[model samples]
Target: MIHANRWYAAATAAEISTQPTEHVICGRPLVLYRAASSGKLVALENRCPHRQAPLSMGTVVGDDIMCIYHGWVMNGAGQCVHVPHQDSVAPSVRVDAYPAVQKWGLVWLWIGDADKVDETLIPDMPWTEDANQSSVFIRFHVGANYQLMADNLLDVSHSDFLHASTFGSHAGRKAETEHVKAELDAWSEDGAVYGLRTLRDVVLSPMAAAWAGTDKPVTRTHKTCWTPPNNINIELIMENDENKVTIHHDHLMTPENETSCHYFLIWTRDFSVHSGYPTDEDVRREQSTVIGTEDISMVEAQQRNKIQFGDPADIPGAADKIVVAVHKRIAELQNEDQGLSAT
Candidate 1:
């Protein structure tokens, strides 16, 4: 229910350090650093109140950030600790602070109204709850609304076209989606918080069965959910006639602006191509046109139309059933924002 209470990715695991790092979240200029004494990462608004200088430009000396402008010092909580050229303690001036936690190999911060930041909304991954998964990490950035990119991912149909040159399987596409099963999943509020693994089935159309020569369906079962304005988590198993199972996940994180997103992922058991991890780089290397031109062309076009036009086709259809369900949930969350008066 908070405006910006959700946690977001601050930096890659390799970049976080005792040295203070400045970043903007939800459009709030913030700085992150490790405590000198405890080595715990902390987040604070980066601007100095006196002259509006960035405190992150200062030094991280002994558990405090010393502003380079005037040697004004602040502690981990953004509480002012010292003001040079004066003996009297400054009347407890402090910069805004955000709750920060480094988990899953990324620094997470809560940036909405702090009072409304529910820890539960911070996001929990039970599968990543294990330590070994720590070794797996993947990162990528796409220029698009975190939501649009997520919707594109929620449906695998794109793989047949967007990825056709590399991942195309005419047998797979012509394969009867109807034979696979049509599942209409939705939340009256939001959409795609999958509970029953909707996209996990192995039924091939007669074409695929004939091509792959499998009498039965070759199903890869999956469960996934998207957290807007930018984030996604998916877990799935890939299966062939051999009946062996491999597990994988796609993890996404969004910055405050919703213009671009970061992806952190793991391929514990699944191959990179199937996971969309390597294909991302492959498309970049082999077909720079698709990743660079096509993706940008589409997102920019979509943004233009989105600005000029109203919501496109609010109703739900076969391909858009998932999108409609998701729009519903987002509408629920933004409902309060809708009712507020300009006054």
Candidate 2:
């Protein structure tokens, strides 16, 4: 089983309401809703214990949820507060309640032991909270393993080939010797692995030029960090003589199951907010075309190949250094979760 102690970004805070929202995290079905009276977000097992009906199908009344099948009321604590036909409520009649909180405009849920929930594990993205930065949020349901998505994000080499039409430039599409010359740096810290690639004085694609507000030769840096069980933050910086632009990406992947995932994406930039040069809709459309079509298509194809061929012994190259680190960290976390390690 995946480590439950880690928090997952289940849904946007605005998505939750008195009407229950159903989501699957780490292969477990969960129901999320806000209390009618208190407006506090609550998460509980989707099932109603009495008849095995989905609690999400019930109505929210004050701080409790009343089952539609029969008027059985369950509170935010997962305790059955009222049974229409009975005078006494059994203390044992309760469902599993997971700890949940609203942070960074998202509803985060902890799926493991309630007592071990760590609030610090949630990603800290001050840019998302910054009023000066204009941000765009998008969510994707990917028909692929979450690991594959994480690996794809950590490895920037694929962008040259896969994203050629959208963001790739001649500097990125070069011989292996040129690729080897790109400075590569990687490290691990605080349960995360970071990788940075610096490309010096490279030609910029049209979109990249527009985003950076420069068509001249530029120094580009691609930095990505992956935090287990599944979250990645990417920073792309393009610098020319007159202008420097930085784009921040927040990628959150929550496993819907072993073979599928929920991908939450956010793109923020400081330069374009007030300039009115590239509108949010324009950027969103470009990203949707590149990510929704190109990126997702490639990853899903890779996933299909993996499923058809099963796990194969593959050779790791210099570009795969960060990928190797990610796999090692995930294995370590899984081992720890299984009580195989003290650290």
Candidate 3:
């Protein structure tokens, strides 16, 4: 749903430790740095119009970000207030300043029409503040439609067959998907499409039972949800008789181009220190390497087919309900956007 705002993930908390870092998201250049004295954060255009030298090339002053070329310094507002080579009284030269909000340990940038972005509409994610739960992030670039990646992330049933040995259920129980609900945001940007798809299934695994110290064919029901413009959550209940849920998240496509998508995803699992995995990062890497490869294959194949087959213009089947919903939402949002653009 970020399509509606100027919203872009500028940088991570770790990357901005003290020095300024240049980041590019959705093709928009950004510079992020923390204030030396007060630890305040700032995000602005990476390019300094004066010489087009990247502001990120500059180091952080007390609270200002100073350019390395000729020592032109700008404050949090991105206004050039001091030119070391020039008189200290030089008139302020302001660069394009992006409205940045620091939340969820990531700096969010508003890159669209500055006057229209509404920060209030930012999506709410509950896990963003779950400090007790540690996490690891895995990022990737997909050579397909952003929507295609979102659709794949939202589909969990494919795991059974596609990821037979890699973090997927081999039990092959009598599983089924039931549509829970779908929603579209009314207040996001021009052509922002947002929705959710839920698939419910029961896990009946003999292997899991043996590993979990439980009876054979231990069965448990779980809920999986797919939310877009950018989110997919799969909640799996392990045999804790305790409904242990692991959430896998997806950030919908930030289009790298007309035909490619730059995507980010992370799967969250309760840290199991004694599961033979010393750190959550290892578990994350294992899962991502396996399942992520599987998805990349399918997504890339789909793209290839489209190029050779010429869109086919029609897809038929029940396996495509979520895809249908995605297309519908995209059309709706696009139509609304066209009108706004004309106005």
Candidate 4:
């Protein structure tokens, strides 16, 4: 089910260009491109009203897109402005035009009432815009439900095993896992779910150790917030007596269909922006490997099992607190959209 009246990350700013790019959100196929004249972002229903041709296959003409099937040209507002060898077109001959904007290095599209378009609803990721931060942005098409991807992120316990070689501390994996389990706290408030996990005197992984400038055990803190429509922000800090490093993780999941999703992430860190340890390329390579292989691999497998056996009634555990809270919030939003009382 899709939530209404919300902003979803359609694509990264760099992803949209003069060439029409197709992206699916909540099963709605959208064609995104920059206006040839203004260079502004434009989003329109991908399907043409005539013959149901995909607008993404068309070429951008001025501020409009011309359908290659019939030469029917549609403007940025999805209005049929020109028809080859024909007179004026009917007002009814148009597609839906969504409100789109570029912010925090991503393209955000409003999926609800145009009158209620609010840019503030977009989740904040200041680290992506900050000049002094080293950031890497990556997008993945996951063959899994968006909820499953969100579940993987909200439940931090998986890193102990799934990402043992990357994010997990090899020397102290067992102790750190136990520490996170015992100290984790999760709750929902003000239409958002939050998780706070603090691991004291925890051994850091190799990459994290390098950034923290220490191989000794340090105090690691994780603060995660999940907003509606699958947007998560994680603030992670690892500190020792001598050095501390902070990393902001922005995870955005938008449904391509009922069973597939587009996962976008931006990892920004305060260290190594100007000098010293790890370079930007190093950070990018590490994060790309970790998220692409470890996280996506597990979720895709879970999705496959879900398709074959259907959803199972499983017992909830302590690590499920944040995931549970997020599920509740999503239900509440869906209820609100349907004019039903929230459970």
TM-score of each: 0.73, 0.93, 0.73, 0.93
Supply every candidate's count of residue pairs whose N, Cα or C atoms clash at under 3 angstroms.
Answer: 7, 0, 3, 0
TM-score of 4: 0.93
Candidate 1, residues 19-122, lDDT tens digits: the string is 77877555567888887788878788898766778988888888888888988888888888788877765655888888877776677777566677666664
Cα-lDDT of candidate 4? 0.84
lDDT of 3 by residue, 158-227 (tens): 6556765554454333444422222212122333433333322334333333323444322333343443
Residue pairs with clashing backbones, model 4: none
* Pairwise TM-score winner, candidates 2 and 3: 2
* Candidate 1 lDDT for residue 181: 46
Best-matching candidate per lDDT: 4
Q: Give the worst 10-residue stretch by lDDT in candidate 4.
A: 171-180
- Candidates 1 and 4 compared: the better one by lDDT is 4
- lDDT, ranked from best to worst: 4, 2, 3, 1
Model 2 pairs whose backbones collide: none
**Candidate 2 Cα errors over 4 Å, as ranges:** 172-180, 339-343
